[model samples]
Target: MLNSFDQKKQKILQEIQSDDLDLSPKGTIDELCIPIINLINSNDDMVTTSSCSGRVSVYLEGTKSNRAVVSKGNHGRWLFVTHEPHDLKDWTSKINFVYTSSFPDPNARLILYKFEPLILHVKCRNLETANKLYQVAMNNGFRESGIGSNFNVAIRISIKLDIPIGYKSPKDEEFEEDILNLFVTKDYIKYIDQLSLERFEENSKKLNQLYKAIEKDLSNGTVLTIKTNKPNWESKEERRRRMVKEGLKRQEELRELKQDQIQ
Candidate 1:
């Protein structure tokens, strides 16, 4: 019988394999994040629940909405977002920023450009495994990583951007490019794009360091090296059964070796 962990793990994997599911704003996993996610899931003692490779985003926030009061961190929605280094040219032609708020304060609502870092959540087989992941993650520059007293570890990068570009309407979701142009210039938007790209590069590097560290730890509990390929995964139960079977055959061989050593 599959335990709770195994059931959850299987469900998560199935979700990954399915094309019909849309759990996040991205609608699916980020391609750059796939290898790392696969690496973690391939381990017998761990599975990734959620992950993001990192992204550059244009976000629109509603400061006066009831939803804003309830969810302070996510009181906004994405106007535009990209998992790769964002190009202003691609976005400018596609997204036309609009505002309809006529509040007393110009800062009442905001349109933001963001560069976010790797965000990963994992479920481990046990508390020990969670702590092991936490230690490796922190060592690899995931300063915001944490493991609970139970069996989950969330790895987060320290660097992220929430740069405000302009204001958006809290009530209505329409305005015009003229409103955005009134404040932010094309050159300034280009500057934001350049800065976001730098953050994206840094984020990718950090994610690589983390997964390599995790892979190293899982392989031998010591020794670290960058791996260029995926590993063949085996279930923990299967591994245990194989070890026990091998031990039976090796018992007589082990006795002979001890005798030979003594002689």
Candidate 2:
């Protein structure tokens, strides 16, 4: 099992080094969470598969008549995305352009949504290592962290948070209102965006500190203990269903392996 894990880790690391690194909308590994990614990859027991540092986006919802179909299409077309704080004027200008473009469809709305809390997926050497990483992540405020495995990859750790940052739609009046209302305005949106960015920064710092603490505990030959609130994000039934699905996948893989060996 250990040998299998090592081989898989080597293959994944090679893929990462060979230009298969993250270059998506979520940004690259270095841009997302370099320090933590570096620290985890440095260990022989782990390698990050995917991650996102979180983002604030201006999304344009599709037409109301075709809402169901368009929701299935591209519900949130990203007009803009930022990992850091943005200028209010820039956002306002962009919003105005989108609002004007969708003139015929009054129901067509431009929404600003902020996805707070970073997400990181790490493949560990074994179930034990995955559990350790999950615990450490939970300690660092990633209450949504969990452990899972498949036949090919025996251990996977996910680090995340359940904080709902931005989903509220700004009032339509705010666009035409001469006087800015506290509820909806370009400045208000900027303020909220800035707050979410600050929270992301704070949580990122905590993650770094947690990594350092884990390192210290390992050096001292002591088990790390963390005190944190119970996670209520996912229900037990949901988790059980997911685990059962993974188990079925693993069984199929093993059957395939056996057939290949016999042939």
Candidate 3:
């Protein structure tokens, strides 16, 4: 007979495999983070509750008041979003609508772009397991990781971007095209998008490192060998940079193997 913890683990893993319980808009696992998620789930004591590989997005914020507390929810709020790094042209196409469109929400105050890094939430069989997993993750590029008494471990990485793309005055009925254009010009938009893509590369490296560490230290070697790549989603420049990085990594691994053989 299985103990309570094992039963709980089995139930959660079953739900994950079923695909019917998913309430998320995307309704699927992130492609890049799948290796790590699979590795973590292979552990007898852990099950992942959520994970995001990363994202780049443009958002429309409701009006802010000095006296009121900041609150957030997304529905009509996201003007643009992507799980992968995007071409500058993808964002530029939306620039015309910023001032020209008849928006439903007159309370909209700002348009901002952001790149959020990888996040993972896991439920452990016990507090000890959670702490052990948290330590392994924290040491391997997820320095912002946290654990709780509830036996949940959260892997929170730090590579990120949050920049203002455009904004308008609260007193104005509509923002002037010239004023908004100064802030979100084609050149400026491209600059910010490129910068966010750079951050996403760094995020991918950290996530890969964290996954390797977890697989080695916690997964008991039962994790499947999953190839995590989405070549179609990458921009030309982004692909070149990632390839260069991979080449350097291969060279480093070869050098280490030579050292081991010498020993």
Candidate 4:
């Protein structure tokens, strides 16, 4: 689905952060900070020109009206913090008050965004074969997006599956569980969030080779196997049991409601 331009971008992006760069602390620094610092330091060639490499003066700005702590200074750019005034501690508190006069209240709703790593260790025949497998994954809906500075791609499929369905019921607990399950589907977990693709792909290629060795033992009588991890195997099995239990509970509730209506 990605165009040639996207592919070019992917390559360019990869150039910015190779495997070695990813392993470095400086490489994983906040993206917003990089640009601000770049503007102040980098020249026409986009190389840093800063003579000294120690601490720099960061200016934090506060809101005009309510004066709540909303944003803080990153390398040079302002970053919005989600947590409220009371929740902040130590250096974060000082930074919070310095940035915004209006601090977020205790009741203020916040959505915390974080990066989760998915590591896959895959074994395969040769380098050429491994490259082909990576190509196949790209063809699927897998995006080239990475988590933090890590080159490993983040699977969007899990986030996509967390949609609410059907009418609302009084059973809040059941509804919450259903919503949670939808978010952690195997397709999302296998490809997107938890498993490391590069490592797993190699492992999977090896698995395919192993499966081929004993095709007779396989249920489908085939040796070929895709490198999708089985993170949801146990969870899925538990889901089946939960479904039966919820069905029974719902039926009983429905029966009671019907009886009340009849009486």
TM-score per prediction, in order, is: 0.72, 0.58, 0.71, 0.19
Candidate 4 per-residue lDDT over residues 1-263, each given as its tens digit: 86553454444344433422222112222222233222311111111111111111112232223434433221112122211122222222232121222324333322121222222222222344344333433344234422322122222111121111111111247533111112123343234222233333433343334223223221233222221112234474564455345544554555465445423
**C-alpha RMSD between model 1 and the true structure:** 18.4
Better of 1 and 4 by TM-score: 1
Model 1 residue pairs with clashes: none
- Runs with alpha carbons beyond 4 Å of true place in candidate 4: 1-125, 145-221, 224-263
Candidates arranged by TM-score, highest first? 1, 3, 2, 4
Which scores higher on TM-score, 2 or 3? 3
Model 3 score (lDDT): 0.66
lDDT of each: 0.66, 0.50, 0.66, 0.28
Worst 10-residue lDDT window for candidate 4 reads: 47-56
Clashes of each: 0, 0, 0, 24
lDDT of 4: 0.28
State the lDDT of candidate 1 residue by residue for 57-160, as single tens digits: 77656445453431234344556667757444558666665432333354455666778888999999998888888899888888899986458888987788
Between prediction 1 and prediction 2, which has the larger TM-score? 1
Task: Please give, for residues 124-228, the per-residue lDDT of candidate 2 as tens digits.
Answer: 766777777767666656666677664112221232222212222344675641121122544555666666667667766765776685575422343222111
Residue lDDT tens for model 3, 1-263: 99887887777666765524244333455667777877887788888888888888776554454323222432124555667674435666755444433333434466777888899999998887898898998788788889965798888988877776665433334743322322555666677788888888888888878877887788866775422233246774675466445544554555465445423
RMSD of each: 18.4, 16.1, 14.3, 23.5
Superposed Cα deviation of residue 189, candidate 3 (Å): 1.3
